[model samples]
Every structure is written in C-alpha cells, then in structure tokens.
Target: MIDVAEHLAAVLEAARPLPAESHDVAAARGRVLRHPVRAAVDVPAFDSSAMDGFALRFADVTAVPATFRVVADLPAGTDLDPTLDTAEAARIMTGAPVPTDATAVVPFEDTERGLAGGLDPVTVVAAPRAPGAHIRRRGSDVSAGDLVVDAGVRLTAAWIGAIAASGVGTVSVSRTARVAVVSTGSELVSPGAPMRRGQIPESNSVLLAGLAEESGAEIVLRTSVPDEGDGPRRAIAAAEEAGADVVVFSGGVSAGAYEVVKNTLGDLMRFDRVRMQPGKPQGFGVTPRGTLLFGLPGNPVSAAVSFELFVRPALRALEGDAEVGRTSTRVALAGGWRARPEKTQYVPVSLDRTDPAAWVARPTERGPRGLGAADGLAVLPPRESDVAPDELVTVALW
Candidate 1:
C-alpha cells in the first residue's frame, strides 16, 4: 500500500512532455504552446480611425458651428491617402486609415447632414476637445517582434485572436497526447445492445475517453474486451500499434481470481493500493516501447475519481502544462457524515452558491445520481470518526 500523494508524485515524475509540433492557428485552441509566439507584424499596421466621422485638423473644429470643405471620402480598406489641412475635413469611416496631418475626429452626429447627404461642404457643430482623439495609433497594441504570448500558455479564443492579429497563421504547440481507452469485462455490453442475464452496459470507456479529451489528450482508440484468455493482451497490443502514448484500462486491476489485467500485466506494471476511498486499487507502468499504462478500478464512480486524481495530471504533464491539478477552494461543510479511518476520501458534493464568499458544501452519495448533481469533489483527509457540520474542507472543482 502507498499514500495517495506518493502515488501521484511518482506518476508525475514518470510523465514527460511530448515533442512539439506545428499546428494551424485555427486548430490550436486548448493546446499548450511549446514556444513563445512572437508578433510577425505590428497590430493596426497603420494609423486608423476608431470611429466613423470627419478627420481634420483640431484647429478646424476648435470653434462650434464651423464649416470646412470636405476634401475626400475615406472608407475602410481604401489605400488613398488624402492630407487634411486647416478648414478642411475628410469623411472617414471606422477602421479606415487616418490621413497625415489629421489631429482629431468629429463624429457625424455633431453635423447637421450627419452622413445622410453630400459632404462637400460639411458643417462641424461640436469641436473635438483635444488632439489625437479617436485615432488608433499604429503599433500601439503590439509591435513587430513583440512577445504576443509566452510558452506554456493554454490557447483560448482570445489568444487565437491575438495570434491572428499579429499576422501569424501558424503556431508551435505541444503535441496532443494520444490515448487509448480499454475497458475490461466479459459481462459488459455496449449501450443500445441487447443484454444477457449477467450483462451490464459498458460505460467506462466513454467516461474515460471524455475525461482524457478534457485534459487535452487525443483519443486514438477506444474498445472493450472480455476478461477471458488473451483478450486484454491483444487489446493492449492494438493500442500500442496505433501509436498511443498512454493506455488506460478501467477494470480487472483488483485482487480477484478472474482479474485479467492483474493476472496478465502484473509482471510488467506496479499495482498498488493507495489509501483512498472508492479508488484504492491503482496501477501504472511504462511498456518497453515507452508507452504509459494506467489500470483503474471497475466501478463507475471509482473510475471517474481515479482518472481525476491520477490520469488527468499525467495527461497534463505530457502536454507541457504548468498547472495540472484541478482548481480547489476551501468551503464550509453543510452536513456531517462518517469517514473511513486511515484513508482519504473524495466525496461528491454540490455547492450552495447563495453566499459566494461563504460557499456551503452539501455532500452526496457515491452513486451516479450524486455524481450528476456534484460540482466538485470534497477532499476529506483521514479521520478517526465522523465529521461535523460547518467544518472547513477543501473542494476540488471539476
């Protein structure tokens, strides 16, 4: 038997970041950047207008009810450059390049015509208070060769927009970890299929594959095999041939006579009983070909908990993420319950958000019904007896 912390530490130490790969910026969302992304060109490559209005010298609009000759009309994406002089203006649209000598912009709302009619003889009723108003200066947001985003950043929508704004069409990101999910049990059948007397719907593969993708791992293969002879071994070989970086087996890891995973792969992997509730039997090892393997418990809740605690972090590490664990918060317990002695327990909980600053955790059962309503897992340390209400506990948000 080993402590939970010790097992996690070992797993993280064994996992290393995969090699970097280049990907299109459009397909780079949710991937960790392996190298810093530098701006290829200055943002707003040229001085542009921030509003649709008249672009003229500030002196022309310093006085109210002033008239100026409209020199030219500048719409967006136009390449013509018309200079603005005293008592002269240009009808400019939003995102249009600002002409040289233009110090201010007066919106059409301040004029009587208001872009509804001809602009040869435009009237400026209000004066722009200061110079350089309503102008988005060139290179103001980002300059050429500037560090747009640093390495190890998880790409989000905003990050993608920034990268595109920098004129970068492609980016270097960490390779997605290829994963294979193998659910072992002879009595399991696929959903929507006819079930026999001792058959149950196989759901662990779906659960594990979803969790793997959420951690940024790409699902390369997902299959279920029986506990009979050579079934588990053949499934593992198929995964290895598919170029999987990690193979996760959801059952046959416990101490039982018909434990296919234990009886077959026990010599190649290290199986340990971590001091944790619902997911104590855990196994992990690297094959001779350097592919990682994880053997989790059979129960649905136990498999989910084991993936969250052990497999998720390993996948994150493989993707070069600096922060791998789920976000945790200290909250007040809404009720009391008995806890197992000398074992840490991860109890499903629903948060009472009426008072956000003082969140209350309502415990739920260890079944699928409770899991459906749970927003997080309450991490309860080993205790001699039952815990009381109002006690503070750390809850790891999913």
Candidate 2:
C-alpha cells in the first residue's frame, strides 16, 4: 500500500512532455506552445483613422463654422498619403491611414454641407475634439518583436486571434497525447449485447474515452478483453501498433486469483494498494514501446476519480502544460458523511451555485442514481472522521 501522492509522482515522472512540432496557427487552438510567439509586425501598422470622417489639422478647426477645401479622398487600403496644409481637409473613411500632419478626425455629421466629392468645399460646424481624437497610433496595441504569446501557453480563441493579428502564421507546440483504453473482465459484455445470468454491461472504456478526450487527448483505440488466454497481451500489442502514448486498463488488477491484467503484466507493471476507498488497487508502469500504462479499478465511480486524480495530470503534462492538477475551491458543506480511517475520502457531490460568492456542496443522493447526479468531488483529508454540516471543505469542480 502507498499514499496517493507517491503514486502520482511516479506517474508524472514517466509522462514527460511529448516532442514539439510546428503547426499552423489556425489549427493550433487548445494546443500548448513550446516556443514564444513574437509579433511579426506592429498592430495597426501605422497611424490610422478610427472614424469615417475628414482628416485635417486640429489648428484649422479651432474656430466655429470653419470652411475648408477637400483636397483628396483617402479610403481604407489606399496607397496615397496626401499631405494636408492649414484649413485643407481630406475625405477619409474608417481605418484609412491619417495624412501626415493631420491631427483630428471629425465625423460627417459634425460638419455642414458635407462633401459630395473629394474636391467639394465643406464647412465644419464643430471644433475638433482635441488633437488625435479618433486616430489609432502606430504600434499602440503591440509592437513588432513583442512576445504576444509566451511559451507553454494553451492556445484559446483570444490567443489565436492575437496570433493572427501579429501576422504570425505558425507556432511551435507540443504534440497532443494519443491514448488507448481497455476494459478487462470475463463477466462483462458490450452495452446492448445479450447478457447471460452472470454477464453485465461494460462501460469503463466509454467512460475513460470521454475523460481522455475531454483532457484534449486523441483516442486512438478503445477495446475490451476477457481475463483468459492472451487477450490482455494482444490488446496491448494492438495499442502499440496504433501509436498510443498512454494505455489505461480497467479492472483485473486487484489481488483476486484471476486478475488478468496484473497476472499478464506483473513483470512489467507495479501493482499496489493505494489506500483510497473504492479505488484501493492501482497498477502503473511503462510498456516496452515506452507507452505509459495505468490500471484502474473497474467500478465506475472509482475509475472516474482515479482518472481525474492521476491520469488527467499526466495527460496535461504530456502537452507541456505547467498546470497539471485539478484546482479545488473551498466551499461550505451542506451535508456530512463519515470519512474512512487513515485514508482520504473523495465523495461525489452536487454543488449549489445559486450564489456566485457562496457555494454549497452536499453528497449526492446515494446509489447509481446519485452518482449520476454528481458534478463535483469533495475532498476530505485522512483521519478526519464524522464530519458535521456547515463545515468547510475543498471540492474539485468537474
């Protein structure tokens, strides 16, 4: 038997970050970058107009009802940088670069006799609203050579948008983990399949596959094998051939005489009692092909908790992410239950998020139905037995 932390440390040590590769920024969302993304050009590129108005010197519009000659038309994407003299204005559209020496932009509504053409004369009805009122300065948002996105960042929509705005087309990121899940049991049958008196529906592979995909992994294989002959060995061989970096096997790891997974992989894996209720048995090792192996208990609740605690961190670490563990927030207990002696307890719970500031948690209504109701897991420390209501505890929100 071992404490949970010791087992987790071993798993993390084996699950080093995968090699980094270059990917186009458009396809890199949710991937962790291995190199910093520096801006290729300045944001805004040059001083541009922020409004569709006339671009003129502020000194020319200081007086009321000022008249000016519209010298040139400057629409967005124009190559002309027409210089404006005193009292001379240009008809400019939004996003057009401001003419050199121009300091303000007044909307068409702010002027009387608005220009029907670039050469038409117009009268300004209002004074310019201070210099540089509606001009976006060059390099104002970001400068060339600036680090827009740092290394080890998980690219999100905003990050990708920033990358695109920086004119960077590609980024270096860690390759995503490829996972395979296998469920082992002689009495288990596929869901919706005809079952005998002793046979039960298999569901661990589906559960693990969903969990792995939720963590940003690509599921390469999902299979089930009975605890006899060479099924376990053959499944592992198939996973290796499929290029899986991690293989998670469910069941057949306890001390039972017919523990197929442990019996077959005992020379390669190290099985132990992990001192956690409902999930005491744990087995982990590296395969000959270098794929990390994790053997979890078959119970649905135990498998879910084990995956969240140990396997999820390994998956994140494989992506070079610094944050590899679940974040638990403190919440008030709405109900209490007895904790196991000398072993930490992870009770499935439902959270009352009625108030954003004050969250309340209570144990889900017991049984499979209650387990289905759970959206969180309340963590109670070891030796803390017989908890009372209204007490404070930390919960990991799903």
Candidate 3:
C-alpha cells in the first residue's frame, strides 16, 4: 500500500495551472487573477468636493463672517474649472470638481444662508479647520500605477469593486477548469428508480459534481454507467468531446473481480491502495489529451473523504491558486475511541467552537449519525492503541 501523502503528491504533480486569459472585471469574479491589476489613473482623477459647500482659498476664511463674491456654481459630475479672485468662492455640490485655486471647503450649514446661499454674494458664519478640508484630493484613495490587486488572488465582491475603481476595464485570470463526473457500478440506479434487492441508488455523481463546482470547476458532463460493456469508455469519450479537463470516476478502482474502470483505463491510469482507512483504493492518471482522471471508492463517506484529501487541492492548483489544501486546525478530542490499526483513520466529527481557543472535536458514530452530522474530520494518525480523551490531533474542516 502507498502512503497517503505520496499519492497526494502524485496527484498534485500532474495538475498544472491553466493558461491566463483576459476577461472583463465583471466576468472575472470568482476567478484567480493571473497578473497584478495596476491603476491606470487616479481613483478620483481630479480634485473634488466632499461636501456641498463653498470652494474658496483658505487664506480668505481664517476669520468668521468673511464675505466673498460667489463666482461659479459647480455640481457633481461637472468639469468646469472656474477662476476665482481674492475673497471669491464657488458654490460647489458634493463630488463636484473644485476650482484650481481653491484650497478648502466649508459646508453650506456653516454659512449664514446655508442652502439658501446662491451663485452670488454669501457670508461665511464659520471657518474651515484647515486648508484642503472637505476635499477628496486626486489619487487620495489610489494613485496611477498603484497595484490595486495582486496576482494569484481570487476576485470577490470587494476586489471587483477595487478593479472597477482602478481604471482597469479588463484583467488577466486563470482559465476555468471543465470537469466531468462518472460513476461506475451495474447495481447502481438513479434515485427514485425502481430498485431490486441487489440494486442501490447512484449518488456519487451528485457528490463529486457539487464538490467540483465548489472548487471553482465547471461541470461539463455527468453520467453513470454499469460495470459491463463499453459504457465507461463511452462516457469518457463524451467528456473529452465536451472539453473536459478532468474526469472523476467512482467505484471501479478496487480489487473487485468486475472493476470496469480499472480494466478499461488500465493502460492510461495506475491503481493504488493508499494507507487510509475506508478510501484506500485509488486510481489516477493524465490522458494523452492531458485530461486528468480520478477513481474514488463507492461508499459516499469514502468518496467524499478521498475528494477532500486529493481532488480538491488539484482543482484549486489548476486555477493558479497558491494555497490549495484544506484548512486544517489542531483541536482536542472531547472523547476518544479505538483507532484502526496501522492505517490513517479519518473520523467524522462535530466541532464545538464556542470556546474558540480550546476547540473540542466530538466524534460521531458511523452510519446515519456519522458523516451527515459532521462539519470536519479529525485526522487520527496510524496507531493500534485507543486514543485518550482530550488528546490533540489535526482536523480538516469542510
């Protein structure tokens, strides 16, 4: 049997970062940026008023009740640069461009007439605290040629807004991965189908498809085929025709007599028994066309755990993300149980995070109360002895 970490290393080695392509910032949301986004122009582009008030030279406002001749009326979005003489001012609205000679702004409420102040004579009842007060100077938020967003970072809502304000209309981002999910087993039938004594519902496709999408991959194809005939090969052909970059197959990599996936793709992929309980049988390979292939266990819990340990990180790396592994944290066990001998055991657990500094992981029993109720898995190391209560171990949160 192969070590789990060795198998993971092999999977990641086969995954490559997709080529970068230009995309509109709106279309690039949730994609990893391939290049740094530098501001082409200042955020504000020009000096503007932050309040509806008088835009005048500060030298004319050191004393209260200073009188001035309002020379111009500037509203938001107007580009007029009116000239001002000594003791002259402009009646400016919020977001309007200030005159070139203006050094400060005092709100209309600070003036005797307040909003009644017109584009003419007005008296200031209060003085501005300092020069350039209430003014959003050019480049104050972002300057030209500033790095607004760094490379390899995923674009979220906040990042999208920053890109929009950075004067960059288009950005380079990693290409989205097209994934296909195929589940192999003759006894498996679709949910709600009439099932005989030996038949079971085919649910691995749904599980793998959702996990693939959550990792930033687009599901290009999904199919379920039996162990007999050419069904598995046909499904893979369809996936390739649909431009799939990865194909995940479940239930046919084990040492069963009728292992369809292992038999059909044996020439391209290599099957391995990883030293991990419940999901040890694994298969992985890159096809001639460079599409990755993965084979997982049939059991739902095993399939999910295998995906979390191997597939998720590969998918993330394909999108150029630097951090690809699940976020693992050390937590103390609320209670302990005997561990599987000589095999890495992943036990479903519910974490008590109320005491954040001292998180306690409670192991749930296998079956209905196990994986379904778990938000994480406490990764118990390979050992034959029973784990003691309050022992510290690493847990990978979903």
Candidate 4:
C-alpha cells in the first residue's frame, strides 16, 4: 500500500550501474559513455588557410593598384615554407599553411596575373589589407589537452565526429546491456500462426523486445511460453544461459490460477503490488541465476506503464544516464474527474499548451493513449473524492 515514490526509491536503491566495455565509435551511438572524452590533440593541429587566396605581406598592399610577384603555388597539405618578404605573394588554396613572412591574404579574384607569370610586382585593385585576414589561427576551435566531451554523455553522431576530429580512432564506451524478454500466457498465439477460438495474438514479446532494443540493450533472447510451470521454467533457464543482464516477463504476476510465472519464480523474486491502478501487479528482484528479473502484468497498457515506471529507470541507471525516469509535470485539469480513490490512479491524458502560461490536460480511455493520443499520464491521488477543473495535477510526461 506504499506510494509510487516509495516503491520507486526502493527499486532504485537495489539497482547498480552495469559494467563497462570497449566498443567502436560507430557502434557506440545511443550508448552511454563510461569515461571522459578529452581531446587527444588540438583541433586543426597547425595553422592552416581559412580561404583560397594569395598569401602576401600587408605592407606590400599599402597603396592602391599594388601587386606582388607570385613566388609559388601552394595547395592543400603542402609543407613547403615559402617566405613572403618584398612585395611577393604565394598562391595559396583553401586549408593551405600561410607563409612565415605573409601578413595578409589577397584573394586571386581581386588582382590580375603578373607579367608572363614571372617575378613581377603587378598592380592590385584594393587598398591595404588587414593582417591575419582569411587565416585560421592554431587551436582556435579547440586548445591542446582540452576536455572535448565529458563522461556520461550519450554517444551520438555529433559526439563521434568530435572524437574522430580529436584524433580518437578508437573509444571506450559502456557495453550495451543484454536483455531477455519472455511473454507468457496460454491464450496467446504468435504472429503468422493460425489463431484458434478463445486465443489472442502474441504481442507482448515483440513490444518488450522493441522497448529493450530502443533502450540501448542487445536482445540475447526473445521468446514466449505457455501459462504452465515447465514452459516458463525452460524459458527462464534459456534466458540465463544467454548471459542476459536482465530478464523480463509479461503476464502471470497477478493472482490467477494460470500464474505460473509467480509460482515458478518462487523465492527467487519479490512481488510488489503497489497501490496504483493500471499497473498494480508489478514485481522485480533477482532471478535464480543472479540476473535482474521483472514480471509485468499481461494487459498491454499495464505492461507499458510498468516498463515506464520501473524497468526504464533501472535500465537508464545501469547505463549511467542522468535522466533515468519519466519526467513529471503539473497541468490543469480540463474537466472534473471522480473515481474510487483508495488506490492511486493512472489515467491516460492528452495535454495541450496552446496558452504557454497554462497547460490543459484531459483524460481518456486506454486505446487513445496508445496511439500517442495522450501526451502524458494524469496521476490521481489516493483517497481523493473529486478533482475539479482548474486544479493542478501531476502528470508523467511522455
């Protein structure tokens, strides 16, 4: 009969971060970083060109129509150090290193060619140029030994690019935790299988598998077992043998005759039927094989809610992510609501913030919420008689 917060805290206290592993940057996307991503070397490494132009001394362009002799042509990646001393310019392309004596860069489009392309101080159209123009200063983007990206950041495409640019060919990232999903029920039939009377389609396994995959977990196994002792036991053993860090089961946690999941788990797990509607029959603990185990209710909405409130946070904690749980917000109830108040209720709700200062939320049935028809879940307090309009209520943001 504990509040949701107390239950959540207990679950969190029992969880710990997963072990780290080395992985390629390409494969590390969406995975949490175990270590700091400091710069191995300065960005740009050395002074290079910011534009394609001729490198010349600023003093040479003091008067109008003044041009310098083209000494040599420098393209990208050229290491030759040609000095520009007396009214001389070096033909430089983009990303080329500037000469030592050069103070400014005159774009080739602003001047005419020297006589016969020989050593001649030709005329320039523009006046005096500024020193260091079109020059990319060394380490302007990043200084040497700078902490480019910090630890605990979720590796992304931008992070990968930064790491590669910082000379990190390989990276050490947290290994994706492996998860095993098992859906149990005697009346469930797999997709593409023939359906029989009094049977429903098997979807919890797919849903659980998709959720695990989206949460940066590698699926070691995805299976379905009948509402029987032997089948569920076999599935549990298979999951443990796959080296899964977490094993999830949908259905058979409630008080039902076919609740083989609860009976088979025996003393290996702890059931927590919180005083919350829509997801009351939720359970989690360690499996017989020492891996984390969670038994979610069979109802689609119930299972989804259980995953959000319990399993999602645990996964995030193991991955070292700070934003581990569903964010909650306060919204004004658009209409009045009355329900049996002894138990906390989770009502599917749609939110609208057309007026930035206030948000309006309206509750609806389960199916509407599944289609993203609701932006959040309205949390009704336990033992409240009625909730009136304009009253602020807590909502779990999607």
RMSD of each: 2.2, 2.4, 3.0, 4.1
Considering only N, C-alpha and C atoms within 3 Å, which residue pairs clash in candidate 4?
Answer: 65-124, 66-124, 341-383
TM-score of 3: 0.87
lDDT of each: 0.89, 0.89, 0.90, 0.78
In candidate 2, what residue range of length 10 has the lowest lDDT sum?
A: 113-122
Candidate 1: clashing residue pairs, number: 0
Compare candidates 1 and 4 on lDDT and give the better one. 1
Please report how far candidate 1 places residue 328 from its true position, in Å. 2.8
Q: What TM-score fits each model?
A: 0.92, 0.91, 0.87, 0.82
What is the C-alpha lDDT profile of model 3 across 57-147, one tens digit per residue? Answer: 9999899889999988999989799988999999999999989999999899899887685776889999999999999999999999999
lDDT of 4 by residue, 275-387 (tens): 88888887778764557888999987788777777788877777877678677999998886786577787878888879989989887665524524767788888765688
Stretches of candidate 2 exceeding 4 Å from the true structure: 107-129, 366-372, 383-385
lDDT of 2 by residue, 152-269 (tens): 7899999999999999999999999999999999999999999999999999999899999999999999999988977778888899999999999999999888889999998778
What tens digits encode model 1's per-residue C-alpha lDDT throughout 319-387? Answer: 888788899999988877677888999999999999878999998776867887899999999989788
Model 4 weakest 10-residue run by lDDT: 113-122
Ranking under lDDT, best-scoring first? 3, 1, 2, 4
Stretches off by above 4 angstroms in model 1 are 339-341, 354-359, 383-387, 390-392
